[model samples]
Target: MTNSELAVKAVIDTWNQTIARFDSILDKLTDEQLENEVAPGKNRGVYILGHMVAVHDRLMPLLGFGPQSYPELDEVFLTSPDKAKATPPIATLRTQWKEVNANLAKYYAQLSADDWFGKHTAVTADDFAKEPHRNKFNVLVSRTNHLSYHFGQLILMK
Candidate 1:
């Protein structure tokens, strides 16, 4: 495979692996434990899953994917300053998490070499300025990086 192809494959693999790790963590939690916050400022497993889904959902669309089929991103990450805020039940959050992960994987798997290398402009929420963003390959890398960062937070909650 070409370098670009290998890069894209690496991104996809990393995303899948990280998401699977999140799922494995979630699977071990009971409904009550999913909502249990380990610290004053930290979120529980359910909230972390919801936040992960939201972040991926938003970033995917920015990379030319469709709107997330799940709840709003803010609802998960910004609903309240307190991490103990009420979130959806564990079962429902798990279903949504799975759906988002599947959608991201499907979209990412369909990317071609050109798609990975194509130049694209990214718009920040702060203003109308559009920054030159990396190709889809880099975007995928960022996505996985973002996921991994949040996954660390999730692990810390344990």
Candidate 2:
């Protein structure tokens, strides 16, 4: 395969691996454990889960796919900090996580190497022309780092 194809596969693989790590971690934690804070006076496991779901949901629109599946999550998980608003149940958040990622995976599979290199919805054409690095692939790479950051925090619960 070409270098661009290889690059796309590498990022996609890393993304899937990160998702799997979260799935494994989440599966082991009970709802009661999810109630505990990741650190003293810090965000709770439930809040983090909801936060991730909210963030990932927005990726759809940001990447020019469509509207979010769970815009409601933004208020509780994104706009507000932990305990600022009530979050969905652990079970519900877990389900939403699976659904959102699965949908994104389908969308990812549909992209060509050129599509991955194209600007996402958040960028204007002029800005993209000036800053070609601000593309869809960069978003995924940054988000993978975001997820990995949370993964480190979340694992503290175990």
Candidate 3:
């Protein structure tokens, strides 16, 4: 395989592993456990999962991927200004996580060398505003890093 293929595979593998860990974490939580907050100002399991789904759902579309397509959960909950303030049921949050992971995997599997190397327009006026155009490779790396950071938070919450 080429370097680009290896890079893509590495990212996909990381995402897959993270999803598996997420599944395991969710499986161990009972309904009541999901609602248990670790401490003051900390989120419960349901809140963490909801935040994860929201971040990914929003970023995916901006990456030229799918929409915020997990319809079973309320859009307001996923995109609410106060995401940390609300916690849906454990079962519902788990279902949404599964759906988001599946969608993400599907998106990653469809990436090609050009897809990784091509330039994409940024939807925000922040850091990327200078160029407003980023290589797909950078976008993938950034997205994975963002997810990994949040996964660390989830693990800490557990």
Candidate 4:
């Protein structure tokens, strides 16, 4: 494979591994446990989970897949801080998390190495021409770091 293809594979693999780590941690926690704050006066497990789901769902439209499957989550999870608005049930958030990631995986699978370098919806054509690094693949790289950051916080709950 070309260097570009290998680079894309490496990023995709890291993203998937980070996702699996979250799944493993979530699988072990109960609804009540998820309600507890990760730290004193800090965000709860449910809040983090919902936040992650909301962020990943937005990636759908950001990457040109389609509109978010759960735009309602934006108010509670994305725009607001923990407890700023009522969140959905842990069960519902869990389902949404899996569904959003699964759908995104499908879209990711469809992209070729060249496609990964294509401009995402958020960037203008003129800007993309000038700043080629702001591509779909860059979004995945940043979100992978985002996921890993929260995953570290989530681990504290266990």
Best by lDDT: 4
lDDT by residue (54-130, candidate 4, tens digit) is 99999999999998899999999888899989878899999999999999999999999999999999999999999
In the predicted model 1, the residue pairs found to clash are none
What is candidate 3's lDDT per residue for 31-142, written digit by digit as tens? 7776666456666656666777776666566667856675434454554543434456667667777777778778767878668766554534454455534666777777
Model 3 ranges off by over 4 Å: 70-86, 121-133
Better of 2 and 3 by TM-score: 2
lDDT of 1 by residue, 11-120 (tens): 78888888888777667767777676755656666677777767776766667777656645466465655454566666776777777778777877787977766653
**Per-residue lDDT for 38-80 in model 2, tens only?**
9999999999999999999999999999899999988899888
Scored by lDDT, model 4 comes in at 0.95
Candidate 1 ranges with C-alpha deviation above 4 Å: 71-73, 83-85, 119-121, 124-133, 156-158
Q: Between candidates 2 and 3, which one is better according to lDDT? A: 2
- Worst 10-residue lDDT window for candidate 4 reads 78-87
Instruction: List per-candidate RMSD values in Å.
Output: 3.7, 0.9, 3.9, 0.7
The candidate, 2 or 4, that scores higher on TM-score is 4
Candidate 3 RMSD computed on C-alpha atoms after optimal superposition onto the true structure:
3.9
